[model samples]
Target chain A: MYKYDTYDQAMVDARVAEFRDQVHRRLDGSLPEDKFRPLRLMNGLYLQLHAYMLRVAVPYGTLSSAQMRVLGDIADKYDRGYGHFTTRQNIQYNWIKLEDAPDILADLAKVEMHAIQTSGNCIRNISSDQYAGAAADELVDPRPYAELLRQWSSFHPEFSYLPRKFKIAVIASATDRAAMRLHDIGIEIVKNDKGEIGAAFYVGGGMGRTPMIAPCINAFVPLDQLVTYSEACLRVYNRYGRRDNKYKARIKILVHELGKKEYTRQVEAEFAHLLTQGIEPPLAELERIKAQFADPAFESGLTDSVDRSDPDFALWVDRNTAAHRVPGYAIVTISLKPVGGIPGDASADQIRLMADLAKEYAFDELRVTHAQNIVLAHVKKADLHALWTRLDEAGLSTANLDTIGDIIACPGLDYCSLANARSIPVAQKISERFAGREGELGEIKLKISGCINACGHHHAGHIGILGVDRKGVENYQLLLGGSEGADTSLGQITGPGFDEDGIVGAIETATGVYLANKEGEERFLDTYRRIGMAPFKEAIYG
Target chain B: MVEAQIRFRDDEPVGDPAVTADSFGDQTNASAVRIEPGDDARALLPHLDRIRLVEVNFPGFGDGRGYSAARILREAGYAGELRAVGDVAVDQLNALRRCGFDAFAPEVPMNPADAERAFATWPDVYQPTTDGRAPIWKLRHG
Candidate 1:
């Protein structure tokens, strides 16, 4: 976990004061709603279907236990005793008052957090592999790079008002847990043939009205010039991205219209110029940031074994924990997707309990997954049983990582003004319908979104369900073959849409096809790629 | 009615009407240039030494191409009064200034007190800009 320096702290505190004044003006009716909307949005306040939703950025999804406690406190103090972790690895409070918003920001500032760039058409909170530092397969920690980008993009004068919301993801491994190819700019830190570390730049990928897989614009931008290269990428987009229609305003559309070759040429030209301008931060700054993420103290020569004496504990360990790079540790993912519950909602008490567990059992830090789960990244394998018992007591232990039960869903028509249909009930129904059979349907990644905004990452789901309003009736469309990992692909829709129950039945039917057709040990995604969408569509539509 | 023009420098008064980038070549006497959102600021690169005023129009606050226009002129060695003229608000002052705008001629009359506050908002900036301000990173590691 990277701690804020004096400068970073000063910047965040200053923003709080700035926003406090803005909110005061808004409350006094001095600034009109239209004028205040962008200002509030810049600070991550949104007028949702019911109340103002304040989204707080958990930069690169890492939080200290103290920070987590403050987040829980914010939920209890300002919001309705709960917070919803979003697909972007940020958290949103559904009910926030205009007057309390500034106070809430001030509170977050005290904990080295703020809601800046969480909303609006700016470079949003930079995300990365949730398992960045602790994963066995990772080449190097990507958060230091992500943090550098976070600082670079924050209130960038030329790019504050981008054509559309821009997102960036940095992944060190080819596993792609953060859905690297689906971001506006995805950087995969890779080693060139010369054995020099650099970034593979994928520009202009997003899921909106149109979904695009970002193409590799530059194969190897020397890591030293990563920020300069990113700036060059954004400069070309900002100067040329469409503004006539909001629907086609994202960088994806701009890159699509310009073609990858022309875009690459333009970016290379700009990057060359910027390199001479001394735009890159000193390499020592990266070393400074990297030092903060140095490995936690581990007792050497600890055993690498977990007791499988209890079957329930064994099942939970098998499903929810990932292999840590260190021998004695495991990365434990606490499932927020409890069966038949609101997918990502955590009560204040539940959050506080997790924060305590992170301090006591794991390291004093936690990471939020894009799948809306919390991870104790450096838990000793010896403490697994005790940790599970504590979490299970608090109803936080649901052994559903990457299962059909671990569904990613958006706060759809229930809380979102932009959504056209409801998404939660569909996820709930499907989760409940398949909870008993989830073990048999291993590694099925299900995602749902109320609208085409794809906030639920429905486009990247192994079994994606999109809710649409067809002639004033809520209709659910089933999409299969999507995967957000190493082999990234958008799901395809089956024939016609279905009603709520019909969609649930359709998933059961679709999975039935997978089970019937799957080769040994093949995940739903693998079976789908091999057999194609014909079987799922035939089974789902028929 | 109050002072809409906030100039950083004492030099001014290019009495010749500012011409658009398209007409800059046509008018030899015009020492001032105006850039629309779509106009290439580089069009005036050849005439930067003589141009005393460069005004970039931001017809809408949300349209940010003007920022690029200002930066382009300044970065191309345009040592003149680069003005941001139109739909400018107090909130954008810090950013507008950072992008190399030394003068402002906004359409809406902003509260002078608020404008003063906005100008004094950040003592330091995060990114290096054409304004020659060292990014906080450079200040840290310089």
Candidate 2:
């Protein structure tokens, strides 16, 4: 975790006082609504359909247990006893009073957190693979670079107020767990023939009203030139992105309209200017940042010898575990998707317990997966049973990781002002319907976004459900084969929109088509690829 | 009414103040305040004028009508007190400075120290936008 130095501290302290004054002005009718709107928005306070909503950045979904506890306290004190985690890895408080927002930001800053640039048409919270440092498969941990980018993009003068919000995600592995391909800018750390680590850049990929699979702009941008290349990409978008219609404002639209070749040409032109100015990052700086991400000391002389016969332990190990690069350790996922419960909402007490577990059984670190679940990376295999029992007691031990019940849902009409339908109930219904399958529906991605903004990133799911209001009635449009990865593809709508019950039935039919055609242990996404959507399309429309 | 402050003309300005904006210069009772817009900014060059301030304007919130003008003034080496004026508020002050405004004349009254304090809340910042100060990351690691 990056701590603020004197300059960093000064900036935050100044920003808080500035916002505090702004709040006072607004309350006193000095700064009119028209004048105060942008000010509030820049601070991550929004006047949504209901009361004001405050979004706090959970940078790369990394939270200290202490930070999580503070967030819990904020929710309890300033809002309803719940806060919603967003697809962008932010948390939103739905019922914030216009007056209390400054206090909330003050609280967050005490723990080195603030919502600045979390909203507004500025660089948003930079995200990366949750398991960056701890992932066994990673060639290099991407956090130090993410932290550098976070520092650079925070309060940047030139790129603030872009055409629309800009997002960037980085991952170190070939397997894109961070969904890098579906971001405005995706940087995957790769090695060269000389074995020097660098970034493979993808531009214009996003899931919003317009869905785009990012195209490779730079095959391998040297680590030294990462900042320069990034600046070039932003310059291209800031210079050319459309400002006429807000809906058509994202850089993806610009990239789509200009065509990939033309966009690349523009970025190359801009990047050349930086090279001419000799503005690339110093090699030493890159080395220094990389050094901060060094792997933690792993325990040697350990082996996986936990008893597997206990049904509870077996079920947990089987469902909620992932392969680690380490021999004696495993990546343990604590599912927030308890059967018939809200998908990603966890009680504050549960947060503290998980934090304690991370400190004890696992390394004193936790990662919030893009799947809206938490991962206790590097948990020694032997400690799995005790961790499972404690987790079971806390009600966090749901053995449905990546199953149909592990649904990712947005705070639809229930919380978000942008949503047309209530996604929570819909997600609940789908999870309950597939609850009986327990073992059959293995490792499927089911995501629901309440509106076209796709905050839930439904377009990236293996089975995507989008809720819309059709003539004042809530209707869901189901799409299949969408993925957020290096091999990213947008899910295509299978058939007509379905009503509340009808959408669940449609998913049931689609899964049935998969079960009939699958060739043993094939994940839903793999099955969709092996047997094309043609079969599922037929099954659903029939 | 206290003093007949002689505002610096484009031709009579001195070395830059290291920061300056139109709003600040316009509102200041300081005689050294310099006001220049359009091509007239170049004329301020030869005077070595004792000008220590400049004022920029925001025509409208959505319209970034004044940002380029402020940057151009900053580029011309007229580093003085940079201020933003007209339709500006506390929200725009941070970005206003990042784009080169050192001070702002909000439509409403405000304490300068409190305004200065507001800029400190966000330690991490992106974008190369700033009035004249180096970014925090650069300052720390530099």
Candidate 3:
């Protein structure tokens, strides 16, 4: 975790004071709602369906034990004893009061966190692989670059008020755990033929009403020029991205309207000019950020052994833990999705417990996965049984990771003002329907979004369900073959939409088709790709 | 009676020079000109030296096209007065200043005390913009 220096602290403190004054002005009726709305949104405050919701940025989804404790404190003291971790690796407190917002921001600032740029038409919270440092296949820990980008994008003068919201994701691993290809700007850290590490830029990939798989605009941008390249990309979008239609204002639409070649040409021309200006930070700055992410000391001869005598513990070890780059260490995922429960909702008590566990067992660091789960990235294999026991006590030890029971869902009509249909209830029902069928399902990634904004990332799910409004009634459309990995592809919608119950049944039918046709150890996504959507479509429609 | 709209030039209160809106046909000859959010700032670059004050209209604060225009003018080496007219608020003062707007002619006259406090909100910034502050990264590493 990057510790805040005096400069960083001053910036956040000033922002909190500024927001306090803005809130005071808004309350006094001096600043009208029209003028106040954008200010509040830029600070991560939103007027949701029931009340004010404040989305706090968990930068690149990494959290210190102290930061986690502060979040738990905020939830208990201000909100309704729980917080919802969002798909963007942020946490939203639904029951926030307009008056208490400044206080909440102040508390977050104390722990080197803020809700800055979490909302509005600005570069949002930059995300990266949750297992960035611990993953065995990672090329480099991407958080250093992510943190540098976070600094560069915060309150950026030129690109703050873009035509629409922009999101960036950085990933260094061979497999994409952060949905890199689904972001406005996806940066993959790659080594060039000369063995120098650089970034591979993918522009315009996003998921919404119109889902697009971002194509590679620039193959390899040198590490020193990453910020400059990103500036060029954003400059083009800010100047040319459509503003007449709010829905089509995203960079993806701009890239689509102007062919990818033309878009790339514009970006290249801007990049050339920006390079001449010498805009990128000095190389020492990169080294300074990189030093912050230095690996924690590991014991020389720790055993890579776990007690698998207990079948339940063994199942959890196999399902919830991932291989760590360092021997004797494991990446432990604490599943927030329990069967029949809401996805990504963690209680205040559970949060505190997770924080304490991270401090005690995992070197005081934790990560929030885009899949809506928490991870202790540096857990020792020897401590698995004890950690599992403690996690099981808190109801956090679900053996479902990428299983059908682990569903990714958004806070749809239940809490969101923009939602046309309910998503959590549907996710709960599907998770319940698929309980105890984890092994048989064979790695099914089911995602549900309440509306076409695709906050739930339904477009990237192998089994995607989109909630829609059909003349006053709730309906769902099923999509197949979407995956957000190294082989990124958007799901295609099958025939007609289904009612709530019909959609659950449709998922069951589709999963059943995969189960029947899958050959040898093939995942749901692999099987679907091999056979195409015909079998699944026939089962759902016919 | 409309309150005399306050204007600041280079962080100091300045007298409002009578700047009239010029028609598109006569814009090149006007010493003072008003540009709407929709107007291209690039078109005025050629006549920037003659123009004493450029008022960029922000119809709504949420519509940030004017910010880009102000930046484009400053980047194009326009040292003349760049005033952000209409829908300006205390919260946006620093951002407007960083984007190279030295003057603000907000629709509502801002309380001078509040505006002063807002301008002084952050003594330093992390990134280098048209604001001319050496980026904190450079300051730290240099």
Task: Give me the candidate number with maximum lDDT.
Answer: 1
DockQ score for candidate 3: 0.56
Question: Which 10-residue span in candidate 2 chain A carries the lowest summed lDDT?
Answer: A273-282
What local lDDT score does residue A31 receive in model 3, on the 0 to 100 scale?
A: 83
- Using DockQ as the measure, the top candidate is 1
Taking the tens digit of each residue's C-alpha lDDT, what string does model 2 give over A1-542? 55555666676766777788889988998778887876677788988778999988887777766677788788888987877666677778888998898889899889778988788887888888877776777887888778777766776665665778889997888878888988899988899899888899999988889898888888898888888798789867866787779899888999999999999998997688656644454667556666755666888888977789889789989999987777788889999898888878877677778878888877677777778888887789989999999999999888998788988898889877788988999999998888868688787889999999998788989999999999999999999998886678889888779998999999999888888988977988899999887998788885
Cα shift from native, residue A149, model 2 (Å): 0.3
Model 3 clashes, total count: 0
lDDT of 3 at A416: 96
Interface quality of candidate 2 as DockQ: 0.22
Flag regions of model 2 displaced more than 4 Å.
A275-283, B1-59, B63-87, B101-132
- Per-residue lDDT of candidate 3, residues A253-365 (tens digit): 99999989999999998788778766799878989989999999877688898889999999999999999999999999999999999999999999999999999899999
Candidate structures ordered by DockQ, highest first: 1, 3, 2
Off by over 4 Å in 1: B1-4
**What TM-score does candidate 1 reach?**
0.98
CAPRI-style quality class for the chain A–B interface of candidate 3: medium
Order of candidate numbers by TM-score, starting with the best: 1, 3, 2
